[model samples]
Target: MVAQDEALTRRLSRRRLIGTAAMATAGLAVAAACGGKETSSNPGAGRSAGKEEKPRKGGTLIGAQVSDVNMGTGYPFVLLAENPFLNYLPVEPLVRYRNSLEPEMVLAERLEYNADRTKAVITLKPGLTFHNGAPVTPEDYFFGIDLILNPRKYGITGSFQLAGFARFITDMKKVDARTMEFTFDRPRANMTDLFAQLPVVHAASYEDVKNGKAVAGTGPYIFKEWAPGQRLVFTANPNWHLTDREGGPYLDGVEVRFFADQDAMGLAYEAGGLDLILDAPATLAKRYRARTRVGPKRGLVYAGLNVTSPLLRDSRVRRALFLAVDRERFVNELGEGFGTVTVQPWPSSSPAFNPALEASFYDPEKAKQLLKEAGFSQSRPLVIEHRTTQTYVNIASVLKENFEAIGVRAELKGTEATAFLAKLRAREFQDVWVTAHAFSDLTPVTNFQQTFPYQVPNPSFYENPTYLDIIEKLSGIDPLSDEAKRQYERFTQLWLTDPWLLPLQPTVPVALLGAKVRGFDEYFLAPGGSPNFGTIWKAP
Candidate 1:
């Protein structure tokens, strides 16, 4: 899914089958040493570039962020806002991704697929213990899987990812104490992409975890403290199994300071109070050019139309709304020229990306005509609610202007980050909402099944049998094959006709690192583009 060279493509394709565990393990080490395509303005930001320096240990790495880590239900399954804190830091997944975006073993010692790929086996690494000092077992992994798939019973957000997994995995069985077998409905390739999303939890402490009373994981860090709306702290795990970096995490601990907004976070980083800033604003990027590292454009910013609404149910109205938005303006102004106007969710690197469909959808006059035909005009404008969060207020404002230009009345409703995300996940919005979503950088199946806007029976409430059938067929075929491309084209055409989710632009991921921060390439290049504190170190 990512932009890969010939070598990377061969390696990924070869490693997707059985008997390549040793090769995959070696690739992980190589990726760790070489990093990915993360480009820093400064010449000497990564290990393989400029002059290399030995990483110093025993210092706290302080990171500042505007969004508070909302540990909703204390489960790291659906809520992506908790990823930097929960996934792969304290709670480890069966596999971890390298900078090249290949899966590497974490809790899983071996992953094997049978011929035709309908069956698979996962062997857990032995002698693993949770942060609570309890042995890590196959049951714990199963418990986490069950909890995610049955979101209603767990009181957590229902995940499209688990639904995608359910489509392939018809049954699962515990083969032994350290191994589990999976039976799929059909042949499946690139199984690691699915496994990488599941983070195992200690079943014994799950009740406490769900209640927010305790935290237990088998990762490189142990959860220490969390002050709501202020900060979160984690100490190193001395016995972390991965010995690639001299046996354990380089930092003694990590402290994440929460700010009300990006400005506040940038100020803290400028004053030397914080060592890193995720998704740094353009102002900070310019001021600290040398210290900033720019990653791939992996997130899609789009408008999710609520098709259940009476007005939005009309195909004409949805098409008009999509046409009214100025995608170029949003890219140049809101994104500060750090994004590309896209007609679809997939990036240019993806096999699903079609250059023929990149034509602009912005047509104010056509939008006006469509609105008038749909029984709305300047005399009696169509009123709609526009839901958004603080981060997208400016984008919403621009959209409001765009809609008004087409003789439509738009009302902006802004909510906090946590509440906004909850509403999006629950499909609680009345009209339409604008938000950015990740997972476009992964496999096309993951993008369809993981992102809220792209999920089946999505928040938009728009459904078509043909579109569903195409997606189902696409899931079972080779992603790089001609048939897969034809399916993607058919699906894209169907989506354009309905226009449920209005495509906007793709934004680049940028982070500001302090002069002393080292080994952050993996964090920036990781899947989902969230920070992984395991390899990070603070220079003394």
Candidate 2:
């Protein structure tokens, strides 16, 4: 295990070096294109050199979102992918990830872990202030941590998402004005990775934030206006600390208009009404290849089986359902071949990702035989109520046909995003639920500890002592260690034998930028593909 850990560290270091070199080379290319001139300090000076453009400061970027930003109770703590602006623009996590997947400090200037990894000291960047003009101190971090760790007291839905920390963090206190300390119940190998997901906010503004009266953060943008179902507006933070580029966060403001769906957003983009489409529909990838920036596979579309349901209680029935679906078809048709068919949730870059299991679970004939062995037949067909949001209704439809082909009757039910999420959180789905989940790329442990479908007391209501033990052990060991890999493989084998969540394919996040949009590629590097408007600028 020690050897494996050392080797993995070496490989990751090499990968980070390569990624850094590539980015440096790209920066040089951009500099050469612009005649090696510095970006203008003047917000209005939009310049170009030899047909290549440089980042300009003054523009109100018009971005489009497929759905309204649902600022649920606890506001930014809910961490919904649909509400990207709330996650990144108005609030910032302590740590963010670069393209190399290495931690980049945001609010935190340094994090030191004890030898046993059971204690941590976090030092905030000095002089950081929230948008409300209050200093960002250790108390603010404690406030946010309290809200997450004691969700019942705050009536929020975030504790379950950070179960690892929620279960292990025994005590937290302020060490100093700019420093905080955390004591864990056990050693946690992925402490920094977990911190990358936690966003800190001003504690004094809790009531205002809860009531939707105001929002404040130490990020690069200040929340200005939110027009319910129509649009939300933000202005650049003039006092932002990061100063990597001249007049950085060059856009003066950003306006995010909410559309009914992707098609409407695409039409708006074509008509020059929008400057950016954060997650363009896969079907439009080819049409906008030149303008689109593709990122690594960060999420997976999976079917969750409710083990409590009689129709799916049998392991044979569940395994049959897994084998009946054609994941490749979902990739080619729904994903437009922009994704890879995967039997497990981990991304290709993850140490837990097993090449042997890639696309190895499809066999219609075997699926039919398994269904027969489980007493399912045309005369006595197994019926399943599959619930999902409209965004994933297409995949659910395909699943219906696939199940029927294997002698199972599948009923499809689609609901609004809010209603679907409510049901999902409540674990009220009858038999099956299909949806896409992120966080599979952060750290292998995150998928099991954070994702709703994979976490303990999961939405599927499927529990095995062995699986629980494996995940518990996984949390305490180095994620890239051979022991961790073996545990993940064991978990995968057990899941296959008694399948609950059927992973279909991993979806690569693709963002389309307008011809004049620049610096938006930085969005792909942040955790969970959250858009970093701070680095994005217009080409004038």
Candidate 3:
């Protein structure tokens, strides 16, 4: 009887122990959920967010790319293609687009114009200094404009738009240390937008821009070293016009490394050696996008037509080619992400994008029918010549496959960069060509308006009368008026519908951020993505 009683007591004891353990686990779960603490599904995720992610403070960033690395003259240099993102960093304009895309002051504290809008007077903030501690002065302004006016001095950057101002620019005189006036050739409603984006040149940096003398600038970082076709290094300029109160750059130093190709750029990113890589095409950029914390942003890619080609002489043929290519698969397969397929020289993300434009869709059957109607048969074989650079070679391959599927043949040709530019500029190429176009953004106008159709017999060989006429009309609109808004929308819609462009991949700035990177959120520019090396700090 005593043994039986002892067994019952032991059974109760065991049940009580299990109940206590269950209560402890339930308490822990409730504490985790209520306190908003994660209970380690991966454990590494919380550790990474806790340990690896650090604020950007001060570090030298190394940017990489596959394009030309020439230090520009502020004229038309290869830098415009590859380095303009960094170039525009320091040259602040009087007015800038705020978070809401409204114009706000940056360098200039205030601005005024004549009664007729022909003359704009600007007042710079006092005490602003260049990287070398030179005070901001108007002479530097004249020097910049002078460089653009003389083709030999600086290449024809804004030559076409400036041509309209040639006679009107009666004076680009500095009235005082902080005051300057621009007397235009004619009354321009959007002149302030034009004025705000005139990249300010530092007088001290002229020697470098002129002869590759030595890189110097007014940017947040100094142009410290450049190993041509290799790497560019920049260190902090403490005197850079930045202040936390002003909502400005937050870190120090920048470095840009050049790679032989996108594959190298990717490898560097994986190795954690590069801070940013700019100018990578669709395939590589998309691959990196999968690993990045944020998705990729769309920028512009120029889908050029060899308009001078006899095959493109028929407007129907040109329009038919637009339908023949499968832009969706090209962007998805080659450029992954939530990519936007655009068909204009302008980036759809730009502030200047007229909201009226709707993107075109890809329809292979429609394209086939269009080609057949244009007299291209399975046997006649209408041949469109496509030139190769690197990115567009994929576009051509897609074209060759898709076009052949649609009863068309494309002759693929490869050319060196210099020859390619020359042939296109001379308008001597046949059928099709594609190139990457990087444009600087102003308030209402897209950069590189130099490509706008110049007058017939024009040296630029860009002859699109409709584009020219629209540019003229839009260029003259008062940005503040509703009527101007209507024109902006109309022209933007015209750009997509006229079938003059074939946009491909969106812009993705490539960079492999190291464990040391910091302060990456401070910089801003018109092109959707670029590095903020000034705000980046290295971890100890």
Evaluate all candidate structures by whole-model CA lDDT and list the values in order.
0.68, 0.70, 0.50
| Model 3 spans > 4 angstroms off | 1-58, 72-79, 84-95, 98-101, 153-170, 245-252, 280-299, 344-360, 376-389, 417-430, 438-466, 479-498, 508-512, 527-531
Best by TM-score: 2
Cα misplacement distance, residue 288 of candidate 2 (Å): 1.5
Candidate numbers sorted by lDDT from highest down: 2, 1, 3
Error of 2 at 130 (Å): 0.6
lDDT of 1 by residue, 35-88 (tens): 455544454653445566776679987877776676654366654654455554
Point out where model 1 deviates above 4 Å. Answer: 1-35, 38-51, 99-102, 155-160, 245-248, 357-360, 377-389, 523-527
Best by lDDT: 2
The predicted structure with the larger TM-score, 2 or 3, is: 2
- Specify the poorest-scoring 10-residue window by lDDT in model 3: 28-37
* Per-residue C-alpha lDDT of model 2 across residues 1-540, encoded as one tens digit per residue: 224324533443333110011111111100000110111112222224355556678888888787787765455665675776666777877776655455668888887778777888889999899999999988887777677667668766533466555567888888889988989888776666667777778898887776665787877788888888889898988898875632477889889998877778778888878787766787765576667666666767788898988788888888888888898888887777776777876655566665555674778887887777788544343433333334477778888888888778767777777777777778888888878788776666767887888888788997888889888888777665556656766776676678888877785666677767776644434445665566788865
For candidate 2, the C-alpha RMSD (Å) to the true structure equals 7.7
Q: Ten residues in a row with the worst lDDT in model 1? A: 25-34
Cα RMSD (angstroms) for every candidate in the order listed:
6.9, 7.7, 18.0
Give lDDT for model 1: 0.68
> Over the stretch 196-260, how does candidate 3's per-residue lDDT look in tens digits?
44556576566665454444445566666667776666666666665544433444656677777
